[model samples]
Target: MSLDLDYLKLKIELFLLRKKAKKTFPEDLSNLTLWSQSTGLKVAVIDNDGFNLKTNLESIGVSVTVFYDYFKPVSQRQEKRKPYPFSQYDIILCDINDVASGNDGFGELQGVGAIEALRYNFPFKMIIAYTGNPAALSRRIKKEKSSNLVDKIYDKQWAPEDFMETFKESSKSFSNPEARWQFIRNRLTYLDAKEKEIDKIREAFVYSCLLKGNPKFLLRADAELENLTQSTLKFLQQGSMSDALRSGLSGLGLISDVFGIVAAIKGT
Candidate 1:
């Protein structure tokens, strides 16, 4: 509910902003579908408060592995156990301030330092930074955006409901490539049939446009899709660049046509 409020507020704000300015790209390019498929999802948490979160996630059927800090060398720490292989996780929730101290492997890695180390070591993994300090977290998020290191940033104090809701939505979308493509196809097929949620339909249309080489839409669809669509489109575009992911999206079906999707959105 709390997470939904933010999205509701965003929709309302976008609707108002659209009236004043020519439709342009949105500042926030968040793709809710990246974690769309969460069945049997693998998650790793690297935070001081990860135990509670890990327990909660596990109750909901999520496979979660918690680690305090990987920056420390095995020789320094008494727990000489095998660490959770970061490569196997679908999502990683990390705290920027959860750092390592003296005589550590990574040399006192803290905050952005820890985040960067994880990003470098696990480039393909989805990393999210969670911290109490919004300002510091935002800075870390921005720094990683160029490299797609961090998929999202949440406040460490996020309400239980909000965080869970967000996690569920993301996980549902995190399905395999074929499922993702099927989802896109289903949304496309219903674009014209769904009359009430025109806003949602337009959003899907905009996201689906990323498959095409160029975007072309009529006046109505163009007006319906403004910043929100642009932002989602950009994120998906970046995500689709990986060879495995691209093949997954394109292998099953020739990426959906942009013009057709635009027309469907316009009901033309």
Candidate 2:
């Protein structure tokens, strides 16, 4: 996994990883028809990247949410920030440096660390590295072990044609239901570290609540938005969420009745 490997090794590793992905991924292309007619992909843009690619990306159909200074939500740089719901995003584009004001081991390149965390915890989602500094990628990817996880890298100065091509390749996973499941499950592992009585939360939300909708999967999504930090939602300023993804989690019953059931489970 060392970044110092020769070009041959790099190509070999990349090939193997990509091959493994193609072979092991769970798929159900039946919903693909739903995608083309929908609002395109759900994109989370870390560090904003100005408006350069935003309008262009939207033109092709993706709904983008810019978490302007994700890592440094507060004035204090010591605090580690929380990511939004995994099921909420389809693709994540992150910059490697100058992401607001903070450092959680990645120093000025905190976005790389943030991207690494997202990739490790949610492996199935499409993650693209978008940055003005390629040198920062060399410096940060090595330390973060994120070289292979990123699907593609788009320089901030990339030509319109180049970015359009990148989008074409990256959006292929939009039709993947299995990949979406992995994204949700892995996020639970990360959330478990901070939330208490997670199993209870899942049961109350999914079986009782979510079962109302996607009964096939007993995974419940929380009804109480209180469990999520204000910053997580606040940062999603212009989040253009799609109805297709009202929630990877869906449920029935009164929000009061369903949410009241899990209200006491502290730290969720």
TM values, all candidates: 0.46, 0.48
- Clashes per model (N, Cα, C within 3 A): 15, 1
Give each prediction's root-mean-square deviation over alpha carbons: 15.8, 18.3
183-233: candidate 1 lDDT, tens digit per residue = 444433322223223233334543433222122333334444444454534
Residue-wise C-alpha lDDT for candidate 2, range 121-163, written one tens digit per residue: 5544567888888776876567767455576677888899888
Worst 10 residues of 2 by lDDT: 209-218
* Cα shift from native, residue 121, model 2 (Å): 3.6
Candidate with best TM-score: 2
